[model samples]
Target: MRYDLKVPFAEKDQAKKLGARWDAARKRWYIDEGLDPADFARWQPAPHDASSAAVSAPASRRAAPAGSEGTVQVGSRFVELPRMCDCLPWEDCDACRLQAWPK
Candidate 1:
């Protein structure tokens, strides 16, 4: 399975250097199979089955409150909550576009 990395905007260039590729339709970056996920641990998406009700919630309903941290299950492992860029109103900034911002 392909895993999407939660790459921050500031690190886009670095990620590209490390071989991550962007999926324009999904607007996320993912490491190709056979690459060591550990190298891109920070960007790994939390594991959640697509069919699960929790993950199926509407975007606004699933958002984490401002300044609050939460956990997401990732392939049987849990990782720190993903952080979003503070630049609100994103303004088409590259970093903001790369983030999965709270609705």
Candidate 2:
């Protein structure tokens, strides 16, 4: 089975050295076939079994409850969001003020 590992920016070099290749479009590193995934297990997005299960399942979206605050699942894990920045209504708040907006 093929695996796409989540190599952090600082550890990209280490992952590459373990035989992971970059997929520029997806912005992730994937293990080449025949490479031992154990060498890059730390970067695996999910457990081997969970990854396979997620891939085989049909994807469907559901609206979260009103006023709910939590992480959103991306590929194999929950995506983290800042506690205060909900990405809505750019107001003059501490979180919004600290955000790095495009010039």
Candidate 3:
């Protein structure tokens, strides 16, 4: 039997544990690498039709709420949009990832 488990990572808590901080301006988290500050950007979202949150993060993560059907961020604050999973950042959007099931 396949055992699926869920792990939890709180923003501030994660930042502390990972030695990073949440950048609200870009809505992404970054860890201090003792180098260029710009190098510590958060993960980019997956590409998909502008219809919902960019990539799917935990709902509990504090972030901008989605008003329309277009792409939006779930929990992450500094995640980038126009994400493409197989492109660069995300190999595929959450929707696309979910759709890519065994056929």
Candidate 4:
């Protein structure tokens, strides 16, 4: 399923950098199958109904989609979220690891 985002115009570039695609006809951004929705949490649409509560939950609190096998595509690459810190894909892995394991 294609998940649409509520991205503002000013943040379009950031959204694009995070792997969201522009739907010119709809004038919105979206992520296709295999791309983890958690990666675009900041711009996810507000839930309108009860079941949608899951959609608005924080990424860490949500489980991976069925059949994902623990990885998701971000831009042109595949990343292992379980191996790296839970930072957004665009964030520096080294920096995120340091923050996640400060000594």
Top model number, lDDT: 4
User: In model 1, where do residues sit more than 4 Å from their true spots?
Assistant: 47-103
lDDT of 3 by residue, 4-95 (tens): 11112544564345445554554554444353423323332224523124234565765755674477547756764553345444455676
In candidate 4, residue 19 scores what lDDT?
A: 87
> RMSD, each candidate, Å?
20.0, 14.0, 21.3, 18.5
In the predicted model 2, the residue pairs found to clash are none
Write model 4 residue lDDT over 1-103, tens digit each, in one string.
7888888899999989888899787667888887899999888877773323322456687887788877755775665455555567776788776766889
User: Which of 3 and 4 is the better model by TM-score?
Assistant: 4
TM-score, each model? Answer: 0.43, 0.44, 0.22, 0.46
Better of 1 and 2 by lDDT: 1
In Å, residue 86's CA in model 2 sits off its true spot by 48
Q: Which ten residues in a row have the lowest lDDT in candidate 4?
A: 49-58
Quote the lDDT for 94 in model 4: 88
Q: What is the lDDT of residue 61 in candidate 4?
A: 79
Mark the regions of model 2 whose C-alpha exceeds 4 Å error after superposition: 47-103
TM value for model 1: 0.43
Cα error, candidate 4, residue 76 (Å): 58
The lDDT values for all models are 0.69, 0.68, 0.42, 0.76
How high a TM-score does candidate 3 get? 0.22
> Rank order by lDDT, top first?
4, 1, 2, 3
